[model samples]
Target: RKDIAVIPYEPRYQSAFKALNEEWITAHWEMEEPDHKALDHPQEYILDKGGHIFIALYRDEPVGVCALCKKDDPEHEYELAKLAVSPGVQGKGIGVLLCRTVISKAKELGCKKIFLESNTLLRPAIRLYRKLGFKEIPKSHPAYERVDIQMELVID
Candidate 1:
């Protein structure tokens, strides 16, 4: 992970972000409407809405991505979504780096909490979330049907 650095999304890495996320989403389940909306227009869907997307670069090569999307809720909650690491370098702590960086970014932006939705089939991701201090919460109106579990980390 020495050479890997997580940085904010840039126009140059737009396609890479979409590709990385599409690979994983399609691998597990078909892309949903929400996926299309976010992936197709990250700037408008995320950044323009007061959200943040961070990209992981290894020696200048795009390899991972994570987004903290501002939610429509009353309380200042952000949705941690679209986290994907390249398959070629899965266990190099890239995903952990992205998660930790995004969480820190959320706190700096005065976020009260960060929430995420994931399916039970993605146990590794769930474990990572828990390790990052996110606790499971009762499901509400999930964006996708694949989301069977919802978690949130209070930015204390």
Candidate 2:
């Protein structure tokens, strides 16, 4: 975690975000319409809509990316989406840094909860979510067909 930092999304990091996410999406499942929208237009589809995206940089190079997408839930929930760390550095705890950043940002924004929809194939990601205190919830209609499990973390 040395020299690694999580920073707010910037237009300059657009390509890095897209590349990082696309690598994982294509590896696990075909890129869906929702994935295309979010990855291609993070500024408009996410940030402009009151959501936030964070990028993890190791020694100033973008290595991972995550997003907190605002949702319509009246309880003020944010969907934690598009988390991906480069394959070369998978076990290096970059994802943890990103998740911690999201939690801090969500609480700072006064969000009541954070949720995510993911597929079972990503066992590592699921485990990370569980370790971060996200409990599994009944699966709901999600944007992507790949999502078989939904999890949420309530912010107190």
For lDDT, the strongest prediction is 1
Report RMSD (Å) for each prediction in the order shown: 0.9, 1.0
Q: Write the per-residue lDDT of candidate 1 for residues 36-151, one digit (tens) a residue.
A: 99999998999999999999999989999999999998753798999999999898999999999999999999888899999989888988999999999999898998899999
Model 2: lDDT equals: 0.91
Estimate the TM-score for candidate 1. 0.97
The TM-scores, one per candidate, come to 0.97, 0.97
List candidate 2 stretches off by more than 4 Å: none
Model 2 lDDT at residue 109:
92
Clashes in model 2: which pairs? none
Candidate 2, residues 16-42: lDDT per residue as tens digits? 999999999898789999888988899
